[model samples]
Target chain A: MRKYLFIYKSEIMSELQYVFNILIGFIGYVIILFIFLNLWKYIYNDPNELINGYNMNQMIWYVIITEILWSSLGGRKLCRKICDDVRGGNIAYNINKPYSYIGYSLFSHLGSATIRGILYIILGMILGFIFLGSFPNLNILSILAVLLSGILATIISTLLIIFIGLLAFIIEDSNPFYWLYSKAMLVLGTIFPIEYFPKVMQTILKYSPIYVVSYGPAKLFVEFSWPNFITIIFWQLIYILIAYGLCAILYKKGVKNLNVNGG
Target chain B: MLMVVKNQLKISWLSIKYALIREMLNKTTFLTNIIFMVLNNASFIVQWIILYSLKDNVGGYTFKQVLLLWGIASGTYGVAHFFFKKAFSLSDTINTGKLDSYLVQPKNVLISAITTDIDTSALGDMIYAYITLFIYGVTLPNFLLFTFFCIIGGIFLTSISIILSSLSFWFSKSDIIADTGNGLMTNFATYPDGIFKGIVKILLFTLIPVGIVNYIPVRVMVSFNLGSFLIVIMATIFIVILAFLVFYKGLKKYSSSNLMMAKI
Candidate 1:
């Protein structure tokens, strides 16, 4: 455990070495936020008006929070790492390691997520202040609930991404799938709140793990109602269990076929 | 001149035929391409629905006009993919050093790279757009002209795709750049050209050149003026020529690998 913690620290230290890149990434995030804000302006068209159950202020606030959440997800970076490891024959090294593959993957993911999450949170809070004039309500219990749910959301997201990324092991070329899925998520994840989806779609998306990553957190950040909070936590736990089971089966199968070539 | 024109048509036809066959036979590649097309169209529908729910039109565009915009965007995207799908995958080729193989080919590397990897799934979107346009655009006054300019717009889109792919040689990462180009293209092309004024119009016309794809042509078709129509055609030719120059200039920077390295 201590060794893994050390590994996580070194990994973070290495990431911090590239301070400029992180700053530039934050700038890019702000630009995207600007574009999305403009889009909402067009969507609203009238001052202080509401569209689709959300007021202009609420809509802008929603966009800001979602952008922050979206940036933190970082599924693309995780997907790229998995594909690179598989393609570059580094999966064999991972297999030889002492810890379970999934454990190692999750830890490393947590480290990367930590850095991105901080940047996103700080930037999001500042942007939220500028946009909303203050933070949303955050009682002690609700704050605790959000922290717990956020962790669960991150786990579910990471595991789901790992499952998708593992397709690289099975398919000769999975680049197109990765690109298509990520882009689809980017557009679909933002356009409509999943709750606004038709009843049937909402039900289907509730089970599909992608919704948990984006919509669940977006809702929590906005409303933070008790029933909504408990529901997401319950679903997230269920997803994590399912993800663990799939990862175990696949990792065992993948390891058996793993062949290490030139480093 | 007649002979030259005839030869060009024959060559282009033959290339299209072969490309179509290659795409149809490759099941995985074909399916992958179709999935992206479906996702893109689905997202557009969602946006359209949202807009309709809000009002009859967005920024003076009627329901039919919105459909027309979708038809135009999807049709041009499909046409571009049919001719230059390989442009979308240029990042992988460059990153993996597979571009060396294209550079070493004796033929025009830009044409060779793009045509060799045809994406026929774009055919699905093309069919969808054609049906939608036929159904919706048939009611418009300038129906025939709209169809004619759609073809020209498609050609311009193909030119843009090729040019964007060629940019991979100059930039280490073209995926983001290509994505940015597509975003800008969709946002600009879907709107009626009249909404943009002054410097923005000039920027789209000269710098971005997205105006050549759907905007300028659609605007001309609506106006029903011979001079505006002629200008649209001239703009398309200019953009295509400029794209050709960009590709050739970038080709000088493209490096290729030999047979031994291609052994995967």
Candidate 2:
């Protein structure tokens, strides 16, 4: 635990040096969010119109929050590192390290994600203010709750992406699965709320990662309620455990067939 | 003059043909790449489907009109990616001195460099575009307009990429600008034009140029207008010429070894 803490601390400092790089990457988020803001503005004909119990303010805020969480987590690079480690035989070197491979990867990436997430939040607030002219109303309790949910959401996504990367041991390419997972995240909860989905999909997605990973934190931020927070955080906890177990299982099994090419 | 034009076209055709053949060497991978990309893109449409279910109109677009927006976007993106995929990587090529090999070639350097590689997955985007067009409803005139716009949009995208990537000659790590610029163009192109107004809309046309890529062309397809079509043509020509000018001007700064490119 202490060693993981060291990694977490060090990785934050290391990732901080790449602030310029991260800012450049934020360009995509800025564009996508701007487009969504425009889309939502054009959808809600009346400024006070409500669709599925969300007002114009909440709807735009929903996009801002989801995009912040998704981009900050840096799900793409997380999987690539894992995928490359598993496929490129770097796992052979990784397993012999002092601590758990999963712990090391999780904490280090989390450190990086923490820096990126903070930046995204600041940017989101500024963008939100400019685009919508108002912020979502939340108290101190709601703010803390949403922050907790966001952390849990990041953990769940990280564990799942690690699990996907470890799949390179079993499959020719784990990229396709990663692609499917990202699209599922993007389409289901990131683009819009689960309520916007068909009733059937809404029910199914509630039990899926869409509930914990992408939708949960944003929902909390937009419409923070005690029941919603409890439900989302509980599911997030369960999904993170499940994701962790999957990675442990895959890693234990996968290390057997690992091959190293060079001397 | 005519002979030079014909020869350049022949060269581009051969370059694309060979790139395609190289990609097809792995049959299963090639097929799966196309298939998977189509599926990947189709998933985004689900968002629109869900949105339209609750509302009759969004951003002044009917459901079908929105699909046309998507179709034009898809078609243009596919054409650009499939035909000039290397333009997207022009910064990397410049950074890594990948230009050395192309510089030695007998044909045009920019053309040879950009048309050398093909993204097989882009074939899926092309297939998806046509599927959406068919779903929207087809007419001979509409079909012709769509095809023309695809070419126009592809050229526009390629030029944008080239112009952005050419910045690598003057600066380190300029791929960031190229990538972000390209992303802005592609992302904005798929969106409904009515949603944007005032300065942002103006920026899209003049600075980002996504308006020229899809919006105007989509207008021509939905309701044929000579004026809009001519703007598309004129803008595309101006952008392409600008791309050439930028690349050539930057080429004078090219040294065979850039420290950044040598980083592996």
Candidate 3:
């Protein structure tokens, strides 16, 4: 735990050096948010009308919250690092280190993301207020729920990326897998609520990672309810177990293959 | 002048040829990238389909017109990346002094730098663009016009990247600015222009040029407007000349890295 904390602390310190890069990266999201704000305004045609059970403000805020999760999760960086480690045979060196590679990766990512996530949330809120005139009407309890769910979703997202990266042990590259996973999250989760999807896809996606990873936190933030909160937590637990179990099995087998190959 | 243009075109062809061969060496990864990119792009179209299902039009764009908008966007992006992928990363090349290779070579530096690589997945985008066009109903004349606009749009997009990246000549770490500019152009190109108004619309046309890259192309494709089509052509020529001027002007300030690197 102490070693992981050290790793986390180091990452946070290093990331602070690139504060401008981090902020500039958010420009794309801001542009997209502005487009969505105008788009929903035009679509809704009336501020009071609810097209898909969400008023204009609620709809735009939903996008803001989900997009924040999307950008702050650090899934792409995690996947690329793991992929590089495996492909470049650096994982063998990492295995010899005092700390577990998985723990170091997870903690370092979380530490760096902690700072960026806060900044992103602040930016999202600023954009929200600029376009919609106010923030989401959330009390302390709901904010707490959203934060907890966001952390879990981040974990699940990171685990999924690691699992994809582990495929580098067998394949030449695992970026294509990350590509598909990100597109799934982007189209199904971030851009629109599940309600906006086709009825069939919505039903199926409810049980998929989109629910726990992207939709759950944003949904709870916009319209909090006890049943939805409990359901999200339950799904997150199941996803956690699945991601962890698969990663453990894959890592074991992958390392064995590497050893047999004299890597 | 004719001899110089011919030599540059030959060099560009060779560069693209080598880049494609290098990528094809890893056949499985190459195929996987292209196939998955098509699927990924398809997912966005699905989102648009769902949205159109809810309403008749968005920003006065019918579903079919939206299809054309996406077709132009994807096709233009494909042409830029598939043939000149390194244009998108020109800032990194300049900042790291990788321009040394192109400078040492006896060719147009900007063209040589941009043509030295291909993004295999962008081929998928090109194919997907045509698929979208086919679904929108393809006639011979319309197909030719779309292809023409895609070339213009591709040049326009690459010019924007070059202009932004050329700023690396002045600033130490301007890659982020280039990236932001590129991102804004890409993001704005997919949406309907009618949604934006006033200052935002003006900025889109002047600074980002998403209007010339995408919106105008879609407009010309939807209805045969001779005036708008001519504007797209003229703007493409103007941007290409401007990109060349900026890149060469910046080249005067380039300090070679002297690092031994070769374009594989």
Model 2, runs deviating above 4 Å: B1-15, B25-28, B258-264
Give the alpha carbon lDDT tens digit for every residue of A1-263 in model 3: 99999898998999899887788878878888988988888778788898778888888989998999989876888899898888888898977789877777778888888878888999998888888787777888888988999989988888888899999888868888898899889888988888887688889999999999999999998888989999999999999999878887888888888842355
For candidate 1, lDDT tens digit of each residue in B61-149? 66667677667767777777776677666655655667666665555555655655566667766766766677565655566666666
Q: Which 10 consecutive positions of candidate 3 chain A have the poorest summed lDDT? A: A254-263
TM-score quality measure for candidate 1: 0.74
| TM accuracy, model 3 | 0.96
TM-score of 2: 0.93
DockQ (CA atoms), all models:
0.24, 0.67, 0.78
Q: What share of the true interface contacts does each candidate keep?
A: 0.13, 0.69, 0.82
What are the models' TM-scores? 0.74, 0.93, 0.96
In terms of DockQ, the best-performing candidate is 3
* lDDT (tens digit, per residue) of candidate 2 on A64-167: 99999899988888888888887677778877789999999999999999999999999999999998788788999889999999999999899988888788
Please give me the DockQ of candidate 3 compared with the native complex: 0.78
Give the range where candidate 2 chain B is weakest over 10 consecutive residues by summed lDDT.
B255-264
